[model samples]
Target: MTNITLQYLTQEQVDQFYRDGYLRLPHFLSPDETEALLTRARQLLSDFSVEDHPLTKFTTGDDNHVGDDYFLTSGDKIRYFLEEEAIDKDGKLTRPKEKAVNKIGHGLHELDPAYRKVTLENPAIKGVARDLRFHHDPVALQSMVICKQQHIGGEVPEHNDSTFLYTDPPSALGFWIPLEKCTAENGALSFLPGSHLTAPITKRFVRLPQGGTGFEELIPPGQAPAHPEGKYTLEACEPGDLVLIHGSVLHKSEKNRSPATRFAYTFHMIESAPHAVYDAKNWLQPTPALPFSRVLDDGPNASVHPAAGRV
Candidate 1:
């Protein structure tokens, strides 16, 4: 791979991230780059045949509804999930694969060349990881293409990324890129700005070693509800825009009711600390089951979890 230099974030941008718990890049990618990503997404979807495909539905809970081998093994492979509501009462698909697919997910960055080039090897991404001041290297752990399918796209409830990708001391960071125009009408993300600074992660969604999934809470849910006066703001974005989110930020997207699909690519990263033992129960383990890739090399005070409180 050729060496690539990324544009560094300005002091103002850095300040904004520290203050707001998130940062938005208006033009993170050029028009051609956006087109290339979209093309790659379409091609992947088209190339996947529906025949004998294990149809999984999008769910936010820890439990795997399908519990099938395909769904279980997809942690390191490209796979598809069908929109739950897209199935009829007769238990048959209501639409064809092109429209019925919920998303192509869970591992595109590690498995697909196009996605890998832009996400894992991209300079801008590496730069952001460094700017965040991680202690150890920044390791990219999970990747997915979220498809907010027209009309049937489901709502994702407010939750933090660390709840699913927990480490001994929380370290997850999210990189979300919209592949097309995202508007309120099409399920744009709404965030509770600055929530990360105050709200502590309460629970974790984990995959049990004995074979299923469950939640482990640091504190009960009652202690961590959004502030009574907290303001939730929606961010409408165009293709190529990137949304970098703190692991503990509270955010969600509403169900899509429009005719157009809202396609976006997303991934998560964590500080690769020798002292940080990733919870054995966390989902998305490394392939060969080794450690996650170190995308960015160094920084200061890397851990994201609180040291002495009821977080």
Candidate 2:
């Protein structure tokens, strides 16, 4: 693992994050570090077999959200999800499995060495969390490598991170790092500035009581604040750049129509203090064997392996 000293955000940068609800830091990771992650992701995609694997497609639209056992139970395990367009009408894959996968998610930070080094072992990430005033020992969860595959990548609808990873006081934050140059043609992220201050987390994605998943309303009907329109700023980033996303910020990315693919690693951190209650019904829940990893205090036991057949 590469040794990275603690890198705290400047006062101006912290101010910008609060004012705009997002911050882009150039060269957050070295070129070699970024390439290492991309290589590992490609290797995992190549090694994953589709013989008996369920072709679960990940979607972010209002309707057709993923609610299968594979998705709901992936919180403590590393698993793959396919692109919506990768499947044909006959319920078969339209392309090779490696090219069809949309993402590998939910436990990479704790289960995979490459991701663990950058997320848990890197002092830079801890420093950033501290700079943001997440003094409550923020717990990192829901790590994923989003492969915006070429030509067949699907579009992500506008949404907030807190909708999926809800905390009682709603203190979720996202760390997004692209492994390749992100461009608008290849599905770069676009953010609605300052929406975090105005937008309310009115609904949360949760595991349904009877099984599967559904969205539960957090506020009374018609009581949510209105979202702003037509002000999304595209954030095209390089391989080593880092984007800090506020939990309530409205953001989305377009389909990758270009020949190039956009591979990015992302994860969320939520306050774990007594005041910030993590809902038990949240779609992603930590198991007793594999609890959520703390950004700071990565002791000897920070890394652990999932049980047999879990990953």
lDDT tens per residue, model 2, 157-183? 889998899888787889999999999
Model 1 over residues 1-311: C-alpha lDDT tens digits?
Answer: 32223257775776676667788989998888888988998888788887878566766644443444566677788898888888778767898777777778778888789888898789888877665554356678878888888998877878888887887777778899999999999999999988877888888876666775667777876766656358899999999999988887889999899998999999988766574668557766776753567786444334322321113
Top of the candidates by lDDT? 2
- Model 1, residue 282: C-alpha shift (Å): 0.7
List candidate 2 stretches off by more than 4 Å.
Answer: 1-7, 298-311
Question: Residue 85 CA error for candidate 1 (Å)?
Answer: 1.3
lDDT (C-alpha, whole model) for all candidates: 0.76, 0.85
Model 1, position 168: C-alpha lDDT score: 72
Show the lowest summed lDDT stretch of 10 residues, model 2.
302-311
Over 4 Å off in model 1, which ranges?
A: 1-7, 61-68, 221-228, 289-291, 297-311
TM-score of each: 0.88, 0.92
List, in order, the clash count of every candidate structure.
1, 0
The CA lDDT at 185 in model 1 is: 95
TM-score, cand. 1 vs. native: 0.88
